[model samples]
Target chain A: MPAGTLYRGREGMWSWVAHRVTGVLIFFFLFVHVLDTALVRVSPEAYDEVVATYKTPIVALLEYGLVAAILFHALNGLRVIAVDFWSKGPRYQKQMLWTVVGIWVVLMAGSLYPVLGHAARELFGS
Target chain B: MSSDTTSATIGPVEGAQYDADNPAPYIEAPRKRTGKTPRATRGNFEMAAWLFMRLSGVVLVVLVLGHLLIQLFLDGGVSKIGFAFVAGRWASPFWQVWDLLMLWLAMLHGANGLRTVINDYAERANTRLWLKGLLYTATVFTILLGTLVIFTFDPNIR
Candidate 1:
């Protein structure tokens, strides 16, 4: 009934929201991905052409974002399972969420090295 | 040690109003968790779906990462991915099986996740049924098409 209750969300609530958002995003990506890959069945040239369009700067950046989303979704997904199944997971739930976030940050940083390096060369290289 | 202020205003904000249209006090509906379902009220499907997400996600970390590394990072990265590369990779049963497993697991996991979403948000029973029906159809079609593509892929079918 109160506006504070409407706006104020704890970590679990936000985490659940992010999980749903990322999961839906990945599902949409896979839809396009599958359809494009299926182009290979039609002809390799078609497949190569479709894949080549993804080499541009914007798509490259989105790919990296996709990677980050997948990483978070996967890690938090594991936490969801633990919370649902493990005996002590609820007690340490906040710790589990933080642990997943920490891993996600480290992994995203590591991934940026390869993803951004390639993107930079593609965008700037003569 | 006790510092109290009479000027502090701690109270609920005014958001609700009585409406003449409905002849009743209007209040925002409490968030309804539409969690009841055949699966929830009957079988072990939700639990299985829960377990599958974790197991498939763990395996997908390996399968998807390996696939991405080979396709997007190794051998000059995305530019190197093409007809010949895919043809060559799928030539081996190893890559074929790897892709097969990835396709199946990711699709099923994602579809199940969406099924949960539909169950939660579709609200009306008819809408939820239709949405889930559409989801399952697409899932089956993609999985079958993908499995066929993996196993029956002809490198020389030019």
Candidate 2:
């Protein structure tokens, strides 16, 4: 409970946190997604109109945010594998942390490039 | 001059004679002693995994929060998300890659975390093996399927 002290316990603690978080996100998103699809069943015209509204800049931003979540979850998972299987990896714990960060950064950058690029191009003719 | 033959056999026992004025042999012990000590060093893998959980937890806070704000708060909320909504988002390579990244990260993180849980709790060797096997199978399947959905999504699918 003291400041600057890290809590250490069982191995699955982080994974449990991640699993719960990702599960909630995925579940919530899937629910909304499925409901929106069902709108098509109610009335295709309304669904088409509603879907069209998602092209706004705000929605685009949210899409990018989702990308960040998924990337973190996946990369951290790989870190878990290395720790669980590899023998000499214990020494490289710090290195693995940095690698996860690096991967997240690279993936986010790559994912955001096209949308931001297009937005920039439209805003400023080139 | 020593009566002991075994002591003299190995080497010249210079300090074999322990007199009041003279000291005993300051035998130099071998530098590298190869034998299992009672207290073995803790497994390095477990130490690394412990470190990983803390680090990953901190990062997950940001990722999860940002995801929530966007999906559940921004714009008209969850009501706006749809197939065409996804299609429109993915039409641009940015969202495609974004979804792809999210899919991969969450699956790997969740899967690995689960794997640790299985290893720690499963009593029998077979139980641990089997639980992990199922976990890995599900994780791999979900990840691959999600990735495929992200990339191969046809906006025109009816």
Expressed as tens digits, the lDDT of each residue in B11-116 for candidate 1 is: 2333245342223455677854366534345577777777788888889878877877877666666667788988888888888889999999999989988998
TM-score for chain B of all predictions? 0.73, 0.62
Q: Predicted candidate 2: interface RMSD?
A: 9.1
lDDT for position B142 in model 2: 65
- lDDT for model 2 comes to 0.59
Angstrom error of the Cα, residue B70, model 1: value is 2.4
Q: Chain A TM-score per candidate?
A: 0.90, 0.66
Clash count list over all predictions: 0, 10
Clashing pairs in 2: A15-B113, A70-B102, A71-B101, A71-B102, A73-B105, A73-B106, A74-B104, A74-B105, A74-B106, A77-B108
* Cα displacement (Å) at residue B87, model 1: 1.1
Tens-digit lDDT string for candidate 1 (A9-113): 666778899999999999989888888888888998899899887777788888888888888888887888788789988777778999999999998888775
lDDT of 1 at B62: 89
Q: Identify the runs in model 2 with alpha carbons over 4 angstroms from their true place.
A: A1-126, B1-62
Q: Ten-residue segment with the worst summed lDDT in candidate 2 chain A?
A: A4-13
**Runs off by more than 4 Å, candidate 1:** A1-8, B1-41
